[model samples]
Target: MNRYERTRVLVGGDPGVAQAIAAEIEEICEVEVLDAPREELVMVKVRESARNSLFYLGEALMCSCRVRIADAMGFGYVLGSKRNAAYNLALIDAAFSSGEEFERMPKWEERIEKEAKRQRDKRAKNRALIERTRVDFSTMDGDA
Candidate 1:
């Protein structure tokens, strides 16, 4: 998976997956904390559908961190003040950046892919449930 997809899965899925992978990498390689986990505000931008224009929705609290594994640099950011999660995310990113070291972590990618699929299945199920509850107001309306 690409970085965006990988990050999304890591952030939304099981936190233990990221922690375990990071711990394994730390034991096998040298990890330098370039930037420790810290909280910050990032502007949320959205498009105004009616006007077809963009605007800032508001600022959202976020946690971010940076680290270096071997020679590759990695960064991670997540909504809210999840310091440990952000740190672990950065470590995982660094592992992926190094390429060769990431290969040594057996089944990590498979685990991530599986989590992504689970999320998709969950969303589909929720959508189906919501669809069943949808009311057909148009059909009940009288001709005027």
Candidate 2:
């Protein structure tokens, strides 16, 4: 998966995926925390539909961290104050960016792909359930 999809899965999927990857990475590589997990506020930007102009939606609290694995540097930023998740993401990022090859890389990627599939299935099921309850108001008489 690409970086965006990978991060989305890690952040939105089961938290255990990142933890497992981080654990494996720690066993082989020395993790150096360049920046500890810290909570901060970031301006949320959005586009104005009428004028097609950019504006700040608001400020959101985000947790971020930086780490180094061998010579490669990795950064993790996620919404909310999830310190552990942020740190675990940093480790996972470092593992992917580092030059060192991992024997378990294939397995890790498989797990992530599976999680992505599961999430997609869940959303589809939910949409189907909601669709079943949808009301066709146009077909109803005004008296009713």
Clash count, one per candidate: 0, 0
What local lDDT does model 1 show for residue 79? 96
Q: List the residue pairs that clash in candidate 2.
A: none
How far does residue 4 in candidate 2 sit from its true spot (Å)? 1.0
Give per-residue CA lDDT, model 2, range 1-144, as digits (tens): 877889999999999988998888889889999999999999999999999999999999999999999899988999999999999999988888886778998888998999999999999999999999999989999985
The candidate maximizing TM-score is 2
Instruction: Give the root-mean-square deviation of each candidate in angstroms.
Output: 2.0, 1.8
Residue 53 shift from truth in candidate 2, angstroms:
1.3
Error of 2 at 62 (Å): 0.6
Q: Tens-digit lDDT track for model 1 on 18-54?
A: 8887788888879899999999999999999999999
lDDT of all the models against the reference?
A: 0.89, 0.92
Those runs of model 2 whose alpha carbons end farther than 4 Å from true positions after fitting are 136-144
Candidate 1 error regions (>4 Å): 101-103, 137-144
Q: Return the number of clashes found in candidate 1.
A: 0
Evaluated at residue 78, the lDDT of candidate 2 is 90
